[model samples]
Target chain A: MSPRRGTRRLRLSDPHRRVRFGLAVVLTVLTIIGGRLVQLQGLDGMKYAAAAEELRLTRLDLPAARGQILDRDGNALAYSVEARAIFADPGMIVAPGRTALALAPLLATSADALMGELTADGRFVYLARGLDPAGAQAIMDLQLAGIGELVEQRREYPAEWTAAQVVGFVGQDDTGLAGIEDQYDDVLTGTPGQLVYEQGRFGLPIPAATHSLEEAVPGSDVQLTLDQDLQFTLEQALAVANENAGVSSAQAVVLDVATGQVLAMGGSPGYNAADPGGVRGDQLANPTVSHVIEPGSVNKMITFAGALEEGLITPETELTVPDNIAVSDIVINDAWGHAPIHFTATGILGKSSNVGTVMLAQQLGNARLEEYLRRFGLGTATGIELPAESNGILLPHEEWSGSQAGTIPFGQGVSMTVLQMASMFQAVANDGVLVPPRIVDQVIGPDGTVIDQPGSEPRRVLEPDTSADLRYMLESVTNEGGTAPLARIDGYRVAGKTGTAQRPNPECRCYAGGGYWATFAGFAPADDPRYVIAISVEQPGGSGGGGVIAAPVFTSIMSFALGDNGVAPTGTPSPEFRLTTDED
Target chain B: MSALPAYDRPQRVAGRRTEPTRVSLQRPVAAPAPAGRAPFVALILFVIGAGLIALLVLNTAIAADSFTERSLSQQIEQLRLQEQELQQEIGAAQAPAALARAAVEQGMVPAGPPGFLIVHPDGTTQVVGEAKPATRPPPPARRN
Candidate 1:
């Protein structure tokens, strides 16, 4: 080889030139890449990321569980449970008719309705709102495309119609529409939440991906003071009472005298809380608090209370009472005809003498009677934890006409709720102290914290001696000679009053062709006076009175109340009552 | 043994016999070698390969766990539904109306007035109320 020639010949491909070329190419590529990075990371980043998330992310709205309504004994009166609802994505459905046919039987709905829903021009349609777990599983096993089930809730009323009026019902959207459910809607309903996560290709959440949960807070439970079993008994008895063709509706309530807790309250024509849609809208309300009636002889107690409080007469004071009396332009008469008789104040109340009561009222005057009426928690809502309570009609003392003065004393012109009538006797039964009745005993939080309701403040309505005297007087009504012998419980002594008042006709706006409200208010073991019960029946086309219609029911309930609570009679012998100074 | 016969046969075929190659040693003889970098290179390759396999296994485990978690969640949802159904059944069976209806079906009648037995402090028992002999009631009203 020629080494001199090789050295002299120019090296055409020099290392320096190759190095420069490589550097230039690398610099140009790096510049391009850097420019692309800036464009991607700075300017269009937000819009791109949002688009990607929109494709890969899914958000779900989680509804919190509604609280339960429990009775005093920790029994569930109403509860909400998660159920499944059948929905269809019409756009994804291949054959609407076939899918509907397969789903109709499981969903318990018409095939035609489902077909219409499945073919509707929307992305989603509900074929059934609630399906049990087994039924939902059956539908899912069919694996029909476009048909899917989602979690929903169904409110179950296990007690059925027992305390339906007091416990109330919920609407389709889980909103409380009536009763305690409606009154404590905020307490029973909870806050909603959201769950957001990145979705994988198979509709499952990606592992360790971005996930967030805004948790839902469940509602607190509200426990009522009602006794479930006693409520059932009252409901059963009231239902039987309403079976008469003449009777339109009936109502009843029982209370604990000391605590003023409503142990049981019910009415006829009650709706099932689980299925409120089957009944008339007007019938869904609790008539005991919402409806009013001329309280009749049930109102005489207040008049007598006022007289005794004002030192007008003692139980043994004798008075000459006639069959009828003319006060202002109206002539009021007793239910039975009688000549002038000398009788004690106890006999006047025990016999439910309208004329005698008015005579005492005349002595007491209107202001004092109205004042007594107000003190009995009348002419106003009872401030109970119920919705749509009525403040019954009681004319202010200044607004009383002449005839009103006569009849108002005997509860003819005056109208009050059944609850008010019951409360009147409660004051006497509780030794002259008045405690406003309450239905809710306490509230239980979701996390197991207990919130007790403040005890109701009781006020004095009558002196203790006057209350004792009243109890002695009222007990005569359930005896042999007085009215309402059927109200006599077997073992315990019962004290009660009976009222039969004519109702005003709605069409005529008068008393011509109206009905009569037969009412009974009483308490058992009259000496101790533990439980107070009141019942009423409205007979629109009948001639029966409270003794005939209302007293028997009271007997059934009062006997049970005494026996169920295991209350013992005082065993004190009954003292002889001087009903008449001239003994018959 | 068959291969030796073939080799003899080729040799006997004389005209196509292969020539024996001559072997010679080089002038610059190789040094007695110490251990070379080949083993180290092999070790590095093995470590890189092992690390890559471990990464693959970890990723597979995570993906599998994600799938298991999804199935478990679905199972949990089904169990929740089952619990709800059971609760509903219990509530229905224990409801007062249902009990009354059941009692009627079993030839049981609603009780009348209840009586009490008074126990005196001296260990004497006396019936307080009249315990009326039970009579058959009128057929129960058709209740729901």
Candidate 2:
């Protein structure tokens, strides 16, 4: 090549152009990087940071323990225990069959079901809930690839069937499904908490990292007025009575007469709270407060109360009573046929004379009879702390037919629950003050604060003088000539009424072939009553009377109640009654 | 080293008095002559090295403590579970049915209506309820 000498320099490599080229390329890359940084850090900084945080954060739910349902004496009827819910990630599993085989024993789930769950699931599947934490730990020790556990709570019923109808049962999610559990669900379920923190790979919290927690507040406990011992006895007696009477079902309730608190309330064939799956739907309810039946001669007490309260009759007042009386297309007869006789007001009740009771009702009339019924808290809810209560069937006095007026006085046409019957006796037992039965004593907070729950306000239904006269008259029912001699506890001044009402047949809409509701309600040491117990058994297609079937059950339970509570029997003897005003 | 410092002090005075002589810190003897800050530098480096070692030890201890805390909490959880299990067993055993079954297994008979004996402060005794001898066994045996 020829060289130009005078041009100052020959172009060997063009160093200036090369330097410009390198600068242009470097500037282009720098501009792109700067723009991207601006986009990320300045333009959408909050959104991108939040997204990254979301990917790095893990949230755990801390479940606060549900409250315990304790009996009046501080024994747990139902409580919550720590447990775990086992789950699996199907995608992470190596072999579904092998995993199922390894987990079946620990989970107590069939391998076929586990295999189905593992093979047919998407990403996540719950294998079992409410597994004991120790068992869950054992499963985790197996180191199955996809299995994990979560915190949960399981309901434990220590008393089991003893207070099942009163305490109720909890379902899969630990929600109360029946009884007190259902009634006090809100008070039993506590607040849940959340823990959110930054997590590293494998979802473990980084040490000393920032985290936030909202403390969980536990639920308040419900202290029931149920005496565990008395309740157990009540249920046992009902079952025995049911077996003896060959009845369909039976119910009984014991109440503290002074405080209107339910010491025990239950029924036969009670479903065990621990295993509610095998129980029938019909037996799950607290039938003592819910089921309504004609009270028969027990309603005669109200009739007697009406007559005595209105000054129409005294305990010794004599009247001419016949064997049967016709009233509006029906003839009502006494339990036994007899000629006309002179009878006292006490005689009518002690004898459970249907004709004599009708005679008393005729004197008081329907309006006054209805007044006494309403005052006794019949035909309405007893307001006990139970669900599905009935305000028993009662037509108004104005709506009563002539036959109804005759039958209602003896508790045939009118219907009431065993609880209502007890409250009637309770009114007499509590010196004429009616205290609506209460099943809850207090609500205890988690932090040891006690909130006292006052029961329904007491109302005076009858005069104290009338109640005294009524108690004296009822004392004769357990006497020699009276109906319920079996109900008498030795050395105790027992008083009660017997009921043998004919159940209305659904097929025929009449009392025929429907059997009877044998019921006996009473209170012991009748002078100053402390407790009132109402016992009833439904004998379908049976002929037993209340004094025979229900009185035995009553005696056993009442004996226990009186003895268990250390109630002293009066040393005085029961007074004599002039059942018939006869000239010997 | 003491004689060297004395000899360098004279040179330092001569340097100030005659003309500005360039000082070289690489010369160890001359470095301490004018600045006298070598101990301060050594002290700072010593502090930094000691701090680094202290941090390492502290970190290791904290890591160990965290591990201990984890294991202890796990043990406490296990103990709590064991206590719960025992309590559950006791509760189940305390149930009326279980107690009745156990009593039956021991050949115990159900007492008839319980009777009370009152011992007055004066030492007089009187029975309240009618104390009857148990004529029948427990309900289960009777049923059989």
Candidate 3:
């Protein structure tokens, strides 16, 4: 081989330089890739990490239930039950028409309406709310796309009409509308919860993925002082009285004399708490605390009580009471025509003589009379847990007209609720100590902690001896010759007063040619009173009087209450009462 | 030259010899044996590969169990819903109206005025009011 040929071969076979060039190119590309990797993994890592987490994580809201209303005996008056609400993902629905047709029968809706809901331009829409589990399951069994059921709580009232007025009702959104339900809505509503979890495809929670949950807190329950059985009895009695007397409406209330705890309170024409939309607005008002009427002869008790308390007269104080007496410009007369005769104070009250009452009220002037009425809790709301209580009409003594004093003395010008009337009697029956009425007994928390409700403090209205004297005088009213003879119980000594007030004509605002309000207020076992009952009938047809129409209602309710409470009759005979004086 | 010097001259043969052979008297060196570490390294690599394969299989089993747990959780939710439904039914059955209806169907009537049996402090009893019968005789005890 020649030296020139060998040199040419050496030039071609020198491979180290080519290898060095290829390695340089590879290192450059790898350096660029490593730099990019460092930037992505270190500099903006948190941003990318958040983005990735968002893709796999989901959040959900959990709803809590409203509390329940229970009677004193733990019977459920109003409660919440688990229910299902059906919703649709309109965006995910494939065939709106077909889905609507499949769901219409189960949802109890028109197919066209359902289609309209399903075709709306939204991600979610409510097809139906508060469906029974069975109904919801029937729809779920179809397995239609975009259809789902959400667990919800529905308010239910088990005792439909027993204490409907007091329990009130809830709106479609579970918000209380009236009565105790509205008063304690906040305490009755519970706290909601939240859920944070990882979601897989189809939005289902991924197994073994990150998950967290916050449990819901349930609401507290309220227990009222009312007895369901007694409430039912009172409602039934009022209903019967309303029907038998042909009255437009009637109301009754019973109270424990010692504690002032209302046992039963109801009014006729009550609305069902389950369905309250059909009831009239006026009827929705609880007549026992919301409606007011002139108390008529019942006001005589206050006048007599005041007189006895002030030492104005004794039980045997003789008075020459005429059949008619003039006060200011108004002439007050007895209900029946009678001659002027002399009688004792007990006889005057037992007969419920308006003339005699006016004479005694004159001795205790308007100032003292008004003061006594105020003390009896008239002209003010009862402050019950129920909503929309009325403060009855009582003008100041300075606002009285010439005849107002005369009419006010006999319960003609003043008006008060039935609860106030019962309260007045409760004061007398409890020996002149007036206790504010209580309707709620306790509140039970979700954790089973009991919170006792504070009862109202007792206020002294009259002396004990004066109350005793008044009780003795009032007992004569239910005797044989008294006005409320029908109010007598067979084995118990009854004390009560009868009232007949002519309702003011709506057009003329006068007491002429208008309907009448008949009322009876009393207690049982006059010596040892346990319960105070008051009944009132409005606008009774024909010639019905309080002694005839309202007295029997009082008797039936009082008897039942006494018997149910295990109160034994005194079994002692009542003292004799004098109907007439020696000069008669 | 003098008849090609017969002893020193090369002989003609069928195949050609490229080089002349030489012989040495010293001991022959042995050819290099394969490295001893190579087989050991190969065996370790095989075992590591098998362990990795087993790990992958176990992970797959765990993933399958996760699916079963999800299915069981779904079943538990369904059972809870069924229990709520049953509770609602029981509540409805015990409602006042339903109970009243059932009572009427069972030949029961509403109670009359209640009477009390008063127990005195001395433990003696006295009946206050008339005690009314609760239910009428069962059709005069139908003759067998």
Off by over 4 Å in 2: A1-28, A47-56, A198-205, B1-35, B117-127, B141-144
Docking class for model 1 is: acceptable
Candidate 1 docks with a DockQ of: 0.38
Return the clash pairs for model 3, or none. none
Candidate with the larger DockQ of 1 and 3: 1
Tell me the tens digit of each residue's lDDT in model 2 across A130-240: 888888889989999988888999999988889899899989898888898998899889999988988867555666776889877888899999998888878878878
CA lDDT, every model vs. true structure: 0.86, 0.86, 0.83
Q: Write the per-residue lDDT of candidate 3 for residues A1-584, one digit (tens) a residue.
A: 69989987776577886678679889999999988888888887888998898889997777777888988888888888778899999999999999999999888889999988999998899899888877898999999999999888888886777788898888878888888789888878889888889887766667668899998888899999898878877876777777764588889899999999899898897888878887887787678998999988988999999889889998889888889988888788899888787878998999988898888989999899999999989998777777878889999999998788988877888999999999999999999999988898888898989987767888999899999999999999999689999998867899989998888878777767578888999998899999999888897343577899899999878877887777877767899888668634
TM-score of each: 0.88, 0.90, 0.82
Could you tell me the lDDT of residue A548 within candidate 1? 85
Least well predicted 10-residue stretch by lDDT in candidate 3 chain A: A536-545
Report the number of the highest-TM-score candidate: 2
Interface RMSD of each: 2.1, 2.7, 5.6
Give the candidates in order of DockQ, highest first. Answer: 1, 2, 3
